[model samples]
Target chain A: MFLAFDVDSLKYDAAGLIPAVVQDVRTNAVVMVAYMNKEAVKRTLESGETWFWSRSRQQFWHKGETSGNVQKIKEIFYDCDRDTLLVRVEQKGAACHEGYFSCFHYRILPDGGVQVVGERKFDPAKVYGKNGI
Target chain B: MFLAFDVDSLKYDAAGLIPAVVQDVRTNAVVMVAYMNKEAVKRTLESGETWFWSRSRQQFWHKGETSGNVQKIKEIFYDCDRDTLLVRVEQKGAACHEGYFSCFHYRILPDGGVQVVGERKFDPAKVYGKNGI
Candidate 1:
C-alpha cells in the first residue's frame, strides 16, 4: 500500500520551498495554496497538521495556531515532477483570513471582471484582530 | 455579476510569475500546477486555453501544444492574496506526461511512504514519442 518516499526526492525551488495546495477532503474544495520548506514538510508529516513557510514573515507557520482554523491532515499527494504537493485536510473554521471558507472566493468572468462567490463565514477583524491577516 | 479585474491587480512574484492550480471542472480534481507570467495570463484569457511560462525552457508553453491535450478554460478564480490562481478546465487528454489524467497520482502514506493512485490514461511513449515529455 505504500512506496518509498524520500523527502529529498522532492524538487524544491531555488528558495528551497515547494508549493502545497490545501483542499477540503469532504467538499473537495481547494482552500488555499502556500509554500513549505523541508522543515515544514517534516513537521507537517510528523504532526499531522498543516505547516507552511511564510514568505512574507520569513518563518514557520502552523496553521490555525492563533485563529483556531487548524487543518487536520487527511491525506497528502505529490505531482509527477515531485515538485508540488496536494494536501487533503479536515478544515476547522474559515480557511481564508478574509473570513471565507476558501481563499479563492473571487471568480473571474470572461470579460476580465471578477465576481465574489461563496459566503463569508466569519469576521476577519474579530478573528485575526484589527489589522487582520 | 462581475467586478473589475485588471491583470495588473495580480501580485506576481519577484520573477514576475504566479502559480496557477489547474483543476478539472467536471471532476473537481486538481490536474496540474504551473507558473504563468503576465503575458501568459493575458494569452490564456484571450485564447481561453491554458498557457504557462516554462521556467526550464524560458519560454511560453501552451498546454497540449504538441500532444493535443488542450485544456479549455471553464472558469478562473484568484485567491484572496491575488498571488495564486485557480483554473477550472475541461481537459482533453492526459494532463501528466506520464500518461495519468492528473499529475498528482502519487499519494503519501502516514508512514512517509508513497503510493500510486488512479489509472494511467495513455502511453507516454506513444503520446509524446520515445523519450516522452
Candidate 2:
C-alpha cells in the first residue's frame, strides 16, 4: 500500500534519522530493526553492507566492517513510516556478528527462563565463511 | 509454536552476544532490528526499558534514559535462532525517537523515487508525551 508521510519524503526529526529493518532475503524472515540517519542509509546502499546511526555515539556504523560478516543487499523497502526502511540482504556469515545468523536468536519465556532461538550459523570465535578478501 | 535451537541455550561464538527484534505491541508491526551482546539483553530486562549492547562500544545502553522517549516493556520473544530475540513493547509516543512511530517509514518505488511512509506521530522538535516524571 502507498504510504502517506507528514511532509514529503522522510523528514527526520531535526536529527537526520530513520529506521531500518533487516529481512532475510530468501526466507522473508525479519531478522532485526535498527535506526539510521541519512548517512547510515546512504552508506548501506553504497557499500552493500549494513550500517546504522548509533544514537548513543551520534555517528555512523557499518555492520561487520571489522567482523567481516557482511550483509549484501538484495533489496530495501520502507514501511508505512517513510522514516523506517526494510533492507533485504544476503548475509554472508553472521549478521549478528555474535556468530548468529540473525539478531533475534533468543526468547524470554513467560516463566522467566530465556530460551535461545535459531542456531549457530557461524562461529564468532574462528569466524566462518570469510570471503577471502 | 515453540522454537528449537541447535544448542541448549543461546551459544554466542565466544562473543557473548544475541540478536534482538523490535516489534510494535499494539499493531504487531516490526519496527527495526539491531544486534546486542549479553549485557544489552540483561540491561533491558532489568531496567524494564530497551538497552542494547553496542558491539562497537562493547557496553550496555538504556534507551530513552538520554532520549526521554522510553519504550516500556510490553512483551519480548525470541525467534528459533536460539541466539536471537523478539522484543514486543508498548512504545510510549514515538518508537523511533526520531519523531515517527515505527522506523519503517519509507518505500523505494519501482521508478526509483523514495516514497515516504507513515506519518509524524509526534513532533520531535518539542518532544511530546514527556510524562513529566
Candidate 3:
C-alpha cells in the first residue's frame, strides 16, 4: 500500500485541520491553498486526486467534483515541523474557481493598487453560475 | 507609499491571521509558508521584507532577523477570496530553518516514504544552535 506515512504523525491544529499549499507542477505556481483534515489527506492520497475540508461548509470537498478542474497528485511533502503540507499536482483546467489559472491572480502593485496578472482561463459565470465559488 | 492596498479588505482567520505563501521570484519555487496578521502585512508592505505573526510564540517575527536569510519582496498577490497571500520574493539564503533552500525539501515517494530532495545550505547547529527551530 502507498499509505506508508502515518496520518496520526501529522500535527493538526486544534480544529484537526492543517493548511495545504497546492502548487502547479509544470509552472511551479501556487495555485491555491486549503485546509485538510486527516480523512481528507488520506482520501487525497488513496484517490490520487485533491480532496480538502471545507471549513465554511463544514464538509468534505473533492476538488473539481463539479467544475472538472481536477488536480492530479505529483508529489506531497510535509514541512520540518510536520504541521503543514505542500502538494505538487498536475492541474487540469484552471485551478481557480474564478476561472484564472491560479487563485492568486490579483497582484499588488507598487503603489498599493491591485492589478490582474493573467487572462482568465474560463468564465466563472458559466462554470459556477453567477454567484461564483 | 507602496502601502496602497487597504489591509482591512483582506480576510483574516479567527486568530486574525492569514497564510502567506512565499515563493522565489526567479525560480518560481515556493520557499516557505507562514502566517501574517494585519499589522504584519502592513509591516511587510512598509518595510519591503517579510514580517509574520508567530502563532506559537504569540509575537511578531521578522524573517531572517536571526538567520540572515531574509526574503525581499518582489511582488505580492492575494486570492480572490482575500483569505491568503502569495508573496514572490528574492530570497537571500536558505528559507528552511533546517538549512534547506526551501521548507519543502522532503518529497513523498510512490510507496508513501519520503526522501530529502535538496542539500542543506547551512548547518542548523551552527545557525540556530543544537536544538534548531
Candidate 4:
C-alpha cells in the first residue's frame, strides 16, 4: 500500500532505525534483513544499492563494499505500518558474510537440530581473511 | 557452527530483544520478521511454536491465537552474530494480517513503482472484524 516515495511517513523506533528486508529480485528469495537509520536509507535510495547501519560496529556500510557481493537495488517498498522496508535487489555472489547465498543457511528441526539448507557459495576465511576484512 | 543450545550467548539489544526471522519450512519462503524477548524465546522453545513480544502493544502473544494462522515451529537458529534468529516453521493459512502468505507481498521496481507479486489469502475485515480483533 505504501507506493509513494514519502520517507517522512515512516515511523522510526526510538533508536531512529527501521528494519529492511532484502530479497533477491529474480528468485524472490530473502537474502538478509538489516537495520537502517535515516542516513542509510537516504544513501540507499540515492545510490541504488543497499546501505545498512551496523549495530555492532556502530557504523554504516554499503552492502558488498567489503566483499564483491553487492546488492543492486531494483525496488523498495514499505509495509502498511511503515515500520519496515522490503528491498528487492539483484544480489551478486553471496549475501552471507559466511559465504552462503543467504544469511539463513541453516534450518532447525523439531528436535532442536540444525541442517544446512543453503550451500556455501564462498569461503569467509578466504574472502574476509582470518581476522575478517 | 552455532549448534549449541546456549541461549545465553545471544546478544540482545539495549531494548532486551532480538529479531526473529520466520520462514516457511517447506517452501523456505520468509513469512515475517518480529522481535522476541528472553521470555518469548524461552516460551517459543518450550511450546514448540512462536511467541512474540509486540513492540506496539508492549505485550506477548502466541502466533495464531486469534486467527488460527499459527506457526508450528520446526527449528530455530541464531545468526553467527547471535543478534538475530531464523525460525523455520510450518505456517498455517496466511502469515500477513492483510491476508497475504507473507508480509513481503509487493515487489518494487527500479523506477520506484510497486507491484503486488503475492496473492491475497484472506480478508482482514472478516478475520479481525471491522476494526481488528
Which candidate number would show the highest DockQ if scored against the true structure? 3
lDDT digits (tens) for residues A1-133 of candidate 3: 3477778878899999999999999999899999999999999888889999999889999999888999999889888888889999999999999899999999888888989988889988888887666
DockQ of each: 0.60, 0.19, 0.73, 0.33
**How well does candidate 3 score on lDDT at residue A90?**
95
- Model 1 Cα displacement at B133 (Å)? 2.3
Model 2: per-residue Cα lDDT over A10-91, one tens digit each:
5464567765667777755566556787666666666667888876567677766667666778766665435456777786
Runs with alpha carbons beyond 4 Å of true place in candidate 2: A1-8, A56-58, A127-133, B1-106, B114-133
The alpha-carbon lDDT assigned to residue B10 of candidate 1 equals: 92
Q: Looking at model 2, what is the TM-score of chain A? A: 0.74
**Which is the winner by TM-score between candidate 1 and candidate 3?**
3
TM match of model 1 to true structure: 0.95
Better DockQ candidate (1, 4): 1
Candidate 1: interface RMSD equals 3.9
What do the candidate models score in CA lDDT, each in turn? 0.90, 0.62, 0.90, 0.79
Question: Can you give the lDDT of residue B25 in candidate 2?
Answer: 74
Give every candidate's TM-score on chain A: 0.94, 0.74, 0.95, 0.92
Q: After superposition, how far is residue B116 of candidate 3 from its true place, in Å?
A: 1.2
Q: In terms of TM-score, how similar is model 3 to the real structure?
A: 0.96
For B28-125, candidate 1 gives per-residue lDDT tens digits of: 89999999999899888888899999998899999999889999998899999999999989998879989899999999986667789989888888
> What lDDT does model 2 reach?
0.62
TM-score (0 to 1) for chain B of model 4: 0.92
